[model samples]
Target: MDFEDACDIAEDLQFDLSGEELIDAYRERADAMVPGEPGRAVFLGYLGEFLAMAGRPEETRCLRGGGA
Candidate 1:
């Protein structure tokens, strides 16, 4: 999906899900995703940023990654 879609979903997730519900929904979507090409990596990056900014009052589900 695109940045706007990701942001919209994040907003929905924040509003509707929490704890196990959030984690399960995240896993369901994540497991069903198609791997993007390298050029499309930026969208994945923006998704985490949007999730962080989406105001999840329960807990943050986004994790961090860095250079090996």
Candidate 2:
């Protein structure tokens, strides 16, 4: 799905996500919907942005380390 469609879905979810978090969740859903697709990087980038926006950049970094 495109960014606009993702944004719409985020809005419908009513999660009170900031713009970055909304994009992040959308990317996560999109990536999950289509595994091994070329869009994974896009989703990852949005996830990083969301973490940073939420002041949880360390969590994001930790996730990249293959551990919880």
Best by TM-score: 1
In terms of TM-score, how similar is model 2 to the real structure? Answer: 0.48
Question: Best-fitting candidate, measured by lDDT?
Answer: 2
Residue 7, model 2: lDDT of: 50
Q: What C-alpha lDDT do the candidate models reach, one value each? A: 0.52, 0.60
* Model 1 clashing residue pairs (backbone): none
Off by over 4 Å in 1: 37-68
In model 2, where is the ten-residue run with the lowest total lDDT? 35-44
In candidate 2, how many Å is residue 47 off?
1.0
Looking at model 2, the pairs that clash are none
Candidate 2 versus truth, CA RMSD in Å, comes to 5.0
Error of 2 at 8 (Å): 12
Local distance difference test, candidate 2 = 0.60
- RMSD of every candidate to native, in Å, equals 6.4, 5.0
